[model samples]
Target chain A: MRIVVVAGGVGGARFVRGVREEVQRHRPGSTVDVIVNTGDDWWLAGLRIAPDFDSMLYTLSGQNDEERGWGRVGETERVSAELHAYGVAPEWFTLGDLDLGTHIARSAWQRAGATPSDVARRLQERWPLGVTLHPATDEEVDTHVQLAGDSAGEVRELHFQEWWTRYRAALPAARFVQHGIERAVPSPGVLDALLDCDTILIAPSNPVVSIGTVLAVPGMVEALTAEAAPIVGVSPIIGGSSVRGMAEACLSAIGVQTDAAAVARHYGLRRDGGLLDGWLVGLEDATAVDALESEGFAARAVPLWMRDLDTSAALAAEALDLALALRP
Target chain B: MRIVVVAGGVGGARFVRGVREEVQRHRPGSTVDVIVNTGDDWWLAGLRIAPDFDSMLYTLSGQNDEERGWGRVGETERVSAELHAYGVAPEWFTLGDLDLGTHIARSAWQRAGATPSDVARRLQERWPLGVTLHPATDEEVDTHVQLAGDSAGEVRELHFQEWWTRYRAALPAARFVQHGIERAVPSPGVLDALLDCDTILIAPSNPVVSIGTVLAVPGMVEALTAEAAPIVGVSPIIGGSSVRGMAEACLSAIGVQTDAAAVARHYGLRRDGGLLDGWLVGLEDATAVDALESEGFAARAVPLWMRDLDTSAALAAEALDLALALRP
Candidate 1:
């Protein structure tokens, strides 16, 4: 089986780590292709930081902070403090000293003629991670949040971090925009993998902001829907709350309820029409099955929590089984 | 009185420190404007560093590394170690952690719409230095040396530090090229200060690479010639050696002898009827005076050894008096 997973950041990274293990074991001939979201890319301190791409890369490479699940471990804060003293400080994101090493390496490598996926693969070489990961597109499409402040009718574009960090999601967002997506074409391998895959899985990740942004790339959604295989999407919303962070703010921005059924509904049961062929809701949200099947889609209730390697592997298996059955 | 001083890097930075005191005390109404050589500019870790400009800025601010006469004090080396581990080990020139802060700030500010002059003024505001400083140009003009080595026929560009530190000027050069100077315009206040100045005091800095590069700016030499004030140059070469670094190697690159008279002669008695009106030599080079008058320049033999503040200030006084006497 050739499995293509549309992934965001941490949750996607963790899920992919487990998926790679399963393919090597039970599904020995399976090839894993990760379509990574690039919505969180931003240029900081004259160096570009592709947060989502790096998170997935670092996690797969085993260099990611196991405790925090983001950023590299053994990070130092001296550079951040010095930057602060100079008053170029962005109060929200603290750039650790050791973390800057990776960024510096990436920026220089990119300048030396390497693409994002190429650089990620080179970074992955340190761990010898044998999997194909591709940025959805090579172009720069930044995700910006338009927010309405104290004065009504006043709207300004906030860089994603400001919406997610400084405001802590309190600002009333007029809309979320993946700016420049209109010009963004999928990377070379993207459309073919989406169209020719045995199964396509959407990792339980931010929908409106991340996976949504990736799908917004022109022709990607159309290509995925044209595939004959089952298209399964794992729910990021579990047990009436986010399985991780900030997905609720994003869901709310799109006016979706923060629940498994609403997540499935937001994606919408599209067995014969759109991208998703099968939708996996949390086992705790079993009540969602009747409504999901009513919309004429393949729906299953499974353990969606990915607390450890085994649990995550089991979750991947559940989603794959659902995808296979739906196609079968 | 308005005084224009032509300068290079740290050695010139020291002389400039003394010039600041002289301009403020003796020529109270006079403003000191320095034409700093930008031939040493290079991009390090994605940030532009103008070593000579930075040295002048730090020295004038009273924040100079007195012992090292370069980077910031109380500096750390964490980033250098990190960079080394990344195979970016430019072992020759060490970038101290605290010193990196200035580079970061300037880069960030410049990227955020501040011009080089605007950034300099902002930096100077904190220090309230007595004089004005300007990079030779807003454009980047780097000095590239053609060396005769095993890698002969390979014209690799070395950031000024690499030549001064990594190779320690050990590489023999065919010639020095001021790359990008053709595209450059003199930085704000450079030509005007030279034209309107009461006197022009050329610091005893690297002539070929430093003062020569400044004079290479379009119409700068013409502006000096047009000014009624005499142009006085202090020799960087002293007692058959450079007062500090690379002056001998730099002179050899231009095929000039490493002696005070040779340096003055290299600038030319009239710079082919262009540059200096008077030349100041050290007390030891007093015998070279007869040749100087014949060359149509009133040469002065002063105690030009700047071992400390007192020695540097006395040297500055003698050069100014010569400049005053030679004024048309």
Candidate 2:
């Protein structure tokens, strides 16, 4: 069996871990491929940093900080402090010494003329990550957020990291823009994974800047609407709130309501010319399932809180089952 | 008074510290400039590294690890370990986390169109290094050592760092080659420092790679021969061997004996189209003083072992006194 997952960062990493666990236990010999959003990537101190890819890599390789919920375990920021001392900018987004190793290698490879896909392959070779990780696109399509209003009348736009990390998303965003998206093509193996997979699952990542950015790639929507596989999405929102991160602020930026049913409707039903064939809401939002089905989504309410590996694996199992049921 | 010093890495750093101390105590209000050898610098993991400049920076700022003889006092190697794990080349040359900060900042600034001099100025701004440091040349003239012979009939040459760090200079070198020296000009302020200084002193650094490479710059020898200032050199050798590092191997590679008299003759007398008007040797090599004098050098034998700050300062003061005595 082959499964393809669309993902972003922390939440996405955790969800994909669950997917890997579920597949390893029940569907032995199955291959799982992840199409990770690279919109959060940017150049800092001349290093190419792909936050989403690093999050997924660290989490899958079991090197991630479980307690802090991000970055590598036993990490140090000595390099970052030195950079600050040298007056390098973007002081808010601290890079741990271990994380910097990855960034340095990526930047070196990129500068040596390797594409983003080539770098991903080289990085993944360092560990047995169980699942293949492919960038959403090889082109640099860093997401920049336009500020809604500024009383100072200056500095109205910021890279997604500056907006998210430096400002903590407090500055209302007018819209999220993916620079270079027009010239981007799906990374090697992304389309193959989607077209040849038995099922497709959207991990519970940020709907606006994460999964939304992935969909916004010129050929992405066309590939999804081609009916290659049954697509099911797990709601990042449960009981009208996000479980982690600032997905609510992100959804609000794109004028999407912070509700399970609203998110499902945002992705919409494939029969109605949208992306998903199935949608999974949390048990707390079980009441929204009937309305979602009435609106043409083969929707189900499941326990969606991925508190531990077991709970996460169970949630992943429920989503896979829902997608399989919707398969023609 | 304006003083200029030609220097290399560890030994040069120690010598400069003494020069700084000597000037502060005796020649009050005197300005000291150091022409640091950039021949040892090379790209590692896509970072522009200048060892001599960093040594001067750390030592002058009191951030050097005195016990270890190099790098920042409190240093970590987490990033280096990660690079090793990723199979990045030249693993023998490990970079401490703190040291990497300087390299990253320098590489970024250089990428942003800053010249080597500009990078050096910006880096020195972080710490009040008592002396101004300038690269020998602004161009990337990294020294490569051509191996004497290879049994495999391959790999005839290696970067200086690879030979020094990886092989520990055990591989006999045929000759030293500076890749971009023909097109190189002295770095900004280098020729000015040489031409306008009241007196010039050569630190007891590696004569072949450090002082030799500096002199190899197209305009450097011409500037030295212009006779604007009296030039004095302190022999890097004592008795029949180098006081520190592998200067002996480098001397042998260039067919020069590792002796104070031999080294003085190598620099020769400025009257005969050479660089030095005076030469300082260790008290142990006092017997060679008369021979040096007969060969047109104002020779002096002093306690040249820089075992501590006081001794180093005394040696620096002796060299300055000798140069002043020969001021014509």
Q: Which candidate is the best by lDDT?
A: 2
lDDT of 1 by residue, B1-328 (tens): 8888889988888888788777666778878888888887777766667788888877777777888768776667777676666654466667776666677777878878887777777666656778888777777678777776566467666556577677888888677777767887876667667766788888998898888888887766777677777889998877778888777888887889998888888887654675777888888888887898788777878888888877787788888889888776
lDDT of 2 by residue, A184-217 (tens): 8887679877776788899999998899999988
RMSD to the true structure for each prediction, in A, is 3.5, 1.7
Output the lDDT of residue B112, model 1. Answer: 88
DockQ of each: 0.39, 0.88
Stretches > 4 Å off in candidate 1:
A21-30, A67-69, A77-89, A102-115, A118-128, A148-154, A192-196, A293-297, A324-327, B22-30, B44-46, B77-115, B122-127, B148-166, B270-274, B325-328
Chain A TM per candidate, in order of listing = 0.94, 0.97
Best-fitting candidate, scored by TM-score: 2
User: Which 10 consecutive residues of model 1 chain B have the lowest summed lDDT?
Assistant: B82-91
Give the 10-residue window scoring lowest on summed lDDT in candidate 2 chain B.
B148-157
DockQ-derived CAPRI band for the predicted complex in model 2: high
lDDT (tens digit, per residue) of candidate 2 on B1-328 = 7889999999999999999999999999999999999999999989999998899899989999999999999888999999988876457887999999999999999999999999989988999788999998999999999998757565499999999889888889989999879999998778777766788899999999888988888988777667567788998999888989898889999999999989988887787878888999999999999988888899999998999999999999998998788776
